[model samples]
Target: MKLKHYIITSLVLAVNLSALAQSGLQKKADNLFNKFAFVNAANVYKELISKNDNADYATRQLADCYAFMRNPDEAVIYYKTVVQQANVPTEYYYKYAQALRGIKDYKESRVWLKRFKDAGGDINDSKFLKDADFINTIFNAKPQYTLKDVKFNSKYSDFAAYEKDGNVYFASSRDEGVLKTHNYGWNNEPFLDIYVKAETDTVVSTKSKIKGDINTVFHEGPLTISKDGKTLYFSRNNFNKQVLGKSNEGITNLKIYKATLIDNKWKNIEEVSFNSDDYSVSHPALSNDDSKLYFTSDMSGGLGGTDIYYVDIKNDGSYGTPQNLGNVINTNKNESFPFINNEGSFFFASDGHPGLGLLDIFGTVSDNNKIVSVINFGIPVNSSKDDFSFFMSEDGLSGYFASNRDGGVGSDDIYAYDRTPQLKIEGTITDAKTNKPIANATVTLLDSNNNQIATLQTDNNGHYEINIDRDTDYYVNTKKEDFLDKIIPVTSKGVEKSVTSINANISINPNTNKVTPITELQPIYFDFNKYDIRRDSTVELDQIVSLMKTTYPNMVIKIESHTDARGTVDYNNELSEERAKATYDYLINKGINPARITSYKGFGEQKLTNQCNGTVPCTEEQHQLNRRTQFIVIRMQ
Candidate 1:
């Protein structure tokens, strides 16, 4: 009897192991599907379905993958199998219609679309099909602009063009000579980095990698610049101390960071306070006043995929709670690369909206806190491929955007678009006494309403230029540290020219001896009593390292870290000391000289911000305020 029981247990164990193996494969397939690795995910689901268990679900996922890949022939096979089965999901019916339409089977696609609507797809959802007005709206659309590929595209993916001053900035995955061992499994391409091209006298030139401390070994950019051009908000893979941060499923999420221009370099980097590792936040777009930030995130509470969300920018440079744009602007599909013009015209790309194919750019106007109008950009501005990251110049005539349509220079390309005649402003900044060109001086352009239209810097030749809409009064403010700010006003109210240059020679009074704190640097915060460097804190620390390497090359500094009043005094002291050393090590890793760090010390609970002392009740937020890392300048040589 004992032998019989042992044999029975072994038999059960073998059966359970086989079941777990099949289940594990399903999870692997699901992860691949989520990441958009369609080809590999389809293979995995195919093998899973061969075992017959959960075959219906596996078939549906496989069909969806093929449909996403635009392989309608293969997708229709599995989609038909699933649709014929009883109790199929309403979405599957709709997806079947889309797959059939991909093969130009309009009549059969209409059949499935009708079934989808009958099974509860809203009339609005079915408008893309069986709606004459909607179909004709796409068919009868007239081209409003001409698009041509820019010179900066690479053989790999290159996209997300944003113009700042005279330079166009974008992200690219070109094989930049750096020998990175790992390639993205999805496309087998190198990670993205921001590239720039100056709008030269006759034409926009080929792009070059942006210098200073911005580019890393990982993905970067698809960024938005502040009107003053001194501040940049960009998307990057979550990282700490040069290591990528991944979620539990081994997927790296994106986060937004803020950095400012100091002296001639982009420094003072800090992650927006609300970024979390559990989800992604990327594709930043700033309001005209820079007081509101719009971005795309797949965090909890979103409609689905990645929804566009906005956060109020406080005066102190911190971000407020994020609010969703709601179902009107978001759908079960992704909505990303949001760009809002000065006229409050909202633009975003979505796959959920009725469109030509994949992701299509959509324009809308908001009034009284509601989406008043939403229309597809249509025709020339869109195609049967992914066309996103639409940005128009202030003139509403010409601009730069990105797309992955066929016949492009690379997997994606920056396209220069011209619609109407636009205005251009050009100038230079110099020292009044020496008459030498001032490179990297920040130039702020303000409209008649005192709205910051753009902020940029003078290049090595002290040259600056930007596109502006005609019929506007404007002022240009060129400023540099140790130099008196120069403001030049101009009236372009009646100028109807396509491109005009305003050649103003800005002169500034130099005051090199004055000592001013590095006010751009913000205090880095840590979680509880943790000392390990976090993704959010690395940006701030990188700023310090960058400042030391560039503007204050010979400056010495000290790290003063503190802890909250929660832990025992001895424990808090050790934790705070660790935090200080962690910050010190981070700077050293970033190539800062050890001799430049005068001291690394911790104050523990001795430096509590509020009365969050021993017996005082305090909220977690208040306690977090006490745990801080401060950078104190020791000397500037």
Candidate 2:
């Protein structure tokens, strides 16, 4: 008996020793890898593996090191060993499949993918299966290289790569970042300029700068060109000898500047005065049509930190007073550098997230003033450091942004990428009766066969846009509680080079041409703060699914639920997300394809046609209508 006890104790000590060794080696590898020493980390991981051939952790680390070093060929071998080792964690299966996909092995990738799904994997992480890089790699037979490094700076020179119409433009710390440097003694860059990179990528304004803009002086950096490359908008600040002024940083105060090309020569360059002396603003982003401007500012009465705001460019060229984008887009954390792609997607950088670092590039899709999918651009675009101020070309196949990670020339140098956003539709809501804009109206965008895609509310001006992809046809339905609902068509033909304004009117008639009339569209309302399928909501979604299933029995519907501006932004967002997902999940279970179903977006307080929350008394019925279920057709084969 004593001999047996000795053997058991001896075995335990061996296991402990092995574990301690593995832990120490892992710590070393992690530290080395974190310090950008990928080769050293790979070596250490290999040493550990050589010591313990059965060490699954060591094997996985080795694979990660190889992948990080852009040696997917080696990573594939290690990852395959781990995957076939069997009984690996489900997450590991995904990693293994991803490695397989990395090596242009989709057929093998599918095998592991099946294991991952069978083992309960998250299918919605589309970056793995749907990212442009992955698509380009698989279909085009190229390598999908993840971001190996990021470097941040006060200025990003890579904006030149994102130039419009063959013009050269970039974000700089030159003499013209802001109108004037205030308390921070920073204003437009006195020396900094959006130095147009010459044919050889030099900061040669002669080739880079527009004739009119070249003379403005002050700092002219961080500039973004219009989608078609016709309009040039940038931040202006007081400047020093050549450095950008702090004023242009959206601090003490900031202003957005604009210029347009008329007869080939740049004309009319000046500052935008919509920013109040009482408030500070910077980082101007113009929408596809050059009609909407999005910026960031610290003008007190906001959601906190810095919030994103927009002002509609009136017909006469004056901008409407800045309107706060609300709590969803403006987290308590600073939201800066607003960017809108040709596809109408909004991208910005923020520290208010679960990212790989300090500030990561986050994005959302807003149409008529409603945001959908406030998500982090993970892995390839984000890292364990700050990566902000992203810009993509007009075609959107290539993107450029600034980051400070491992690979780059210096702090905040430019990085290029191949990217393309899927298609989506956005618009507004109004009263057919008076044609007056309706605020807090719910806009439910459905697809061709009638399925919920996303649900959002209109802004103070009765505007809302539905977020969808190129593969889907859209129907925008407008509804206000206690008011008749109206559904209109919004088609995205891929050639529309501007932000389309789609309007739907909800009306309840007092009298018909001959006598009293009933109504035009049905208003779907909700109970207090609920996302559960109320009989009313069910009736609506059911009507949609009924129409769709009649066309295709094997139809898949995606129901996106929503809520109004009645609670904390984050909490409201969470509730809204739950509401949308619950609606989608319900319909999916009720004969909708779990795969055919696409997404649920919780717009939170971001989309509000009227400032109703915290106000005296917004009708429960109105709030109910504001709370809604939106359907979009995802796939119709």
Which lDDT values do the candidates have, in the order given?
Answer: 0.71, 0.56
- Give the best candidate by lDDT: 1
TM-score of each: 0.46, 0.40
Error of 1 at 31 (Å): 48
Tell me the TM-score of model 2.
0.40
Tens digits of per-residue lDDT for model 1 on 351-435? 8887777777776634344564455655566677877887777655567666677788776776777653324677678888999
Tens digits of per-residue lDDT for model 2 on 485-579? 56766565553324323233444322222222222113344566776667756776676556556755544445555568787888878887877
Which 10 consecutive residues of model 2 have the lowest summed lDDT?
A: 4-13
Give candidate 1 regions above 4 Å deviation. 1-142, 201-207, 421-637
